[model samples]
Target: MLTSIKSFFSNELFNTEKGSTADSSEHQLQLACAALLIEVAVIDQEFDTRELQALITILQTKFNLSAEECETLRTLAQSESEDSTSMYQFTQLVNSACSPEQKFELIKGMWTIAYADGDLDKYEEYIVRKVSELIYVSHSEFIRAKLAARP
Candidate 1:
């Protein structure tokens, strides 16, 4: 288990040049982002239909994934997130591979998922805050993400 987890976080597997896509590194980064989003969706211990929809919508809008791709990514993310010990590894991958704009969009996606059920559970918000910090998102950017996602 740890080996697979370690491989997932291995720098060689995730060292994608920023702005490069359509490669293994991009795929790995996608998986990491998907996992973090799923973590937020389920943090409240009640994964509502609205939250699920929000997750799918966010992935589709942000990554332009087809339904089948979204399903596969979500399934992989769910399994990985269940086995993962911490968010740091995933955020580390994002920080290394993504541009600042990409990171901000992810934080905004997280906030959207957190608010999808119409109330932000304390734990959900905490996860978003922690992820923001881990991904090196500025406090101002974090606040902007939250405000941008506010409905």
Candidate 2:
């Protein structure tokens, strides 16, 4: 009963050069990013359709995932966000693997998911703030992302 990394990426399954089951760094990173957005959207105990669509939008544009691929990842990420206890695993991986600019972009995505319901839920705000800190996004940049993602 483990949440395998490959499951986070997709059920389609991919193999490495040696033919053993494996996920590339690129897929792993994108999964982490997607998982965080899922976490934020579900934080208020409501996985709104708007939030799901916002996540799909972010995943598609940010990771260049096809619409089909984005839906696959979104389904997998939702499972992870619900099954996992903390956001630390995803946030830690993202912080260590991505550049500052990338982290800022992630913050922006989180903000978008948070605001998808047309209002900033307090718990959603709290989750985004914690994620920004976990991913090393500066306070200034975090605030800027919040403002920019307001819709």
Candidate 3:
């Protein structure tokens, strides 16, 4: 699965810019974002269908991915999130690659997933809060994102 993910990132996603550092960075950024979303979705120990749909929508809209691409990303991100020791690995990449606005949007996406099932678990909120802090999103922005994403 890891090899396939690497192949997809290297070949399908950034084939146009192969061998470039920027391509590598972009691939990492995409994976990181997807992994973070997966993290939030699974934090409550139940990956709801609603959360899966919300995650797919976020990846498709935020990364401009097609359905197939989104599926591939979600699979890879699930694997990555499961094997990962902590959220910092994902959040660090986001902090370095994304702008403040992008980071805010990411927090909102996390919130969206948390609320997708019509219930927000405490662990889910904690994971989102931790990611927001790691990515340097202000406390006010975090609250704002939560409010904006509440459905």
* Model 2: lDDT of residue 75: 74
Residue-wise C-alpha lDDT for candidate 1, range 36-150, written one tens digit per residue:
9999999989989999999999988887888877876787789889989898778989988899999999999999999999999999999999999999899999999999999
Winner of 1 and 2 under TM-score: 2
lDDT of 2 by residue, 1-151 (tens): 2347554344464334422333466677777788898888988999888988899989989977789878877876777777888888798889778998889889999999999988789999999999998877889999999898888
Q: Global lDDT of each model?
A: 0.86, 0.81, 0.90
In angstroms, give how far residue 58 of model 3 lies from its true place. Answer: 0.5
Could you tell me every candidate's TM-score relative to the true structure?
Answer: 0.85, 0.87, 0.93
lDDT of 3 at 102: 99
lDDT of 2: 0.81
- Greater lDDT among 1 and 3 belongs to 3
Q: Which model is ahead, 2 or 3, in terms of lDDT?
A: 3
Ranking by lDDT: 3, 1, 2
Worst 10 residues of 3 by lDDT: 12-21
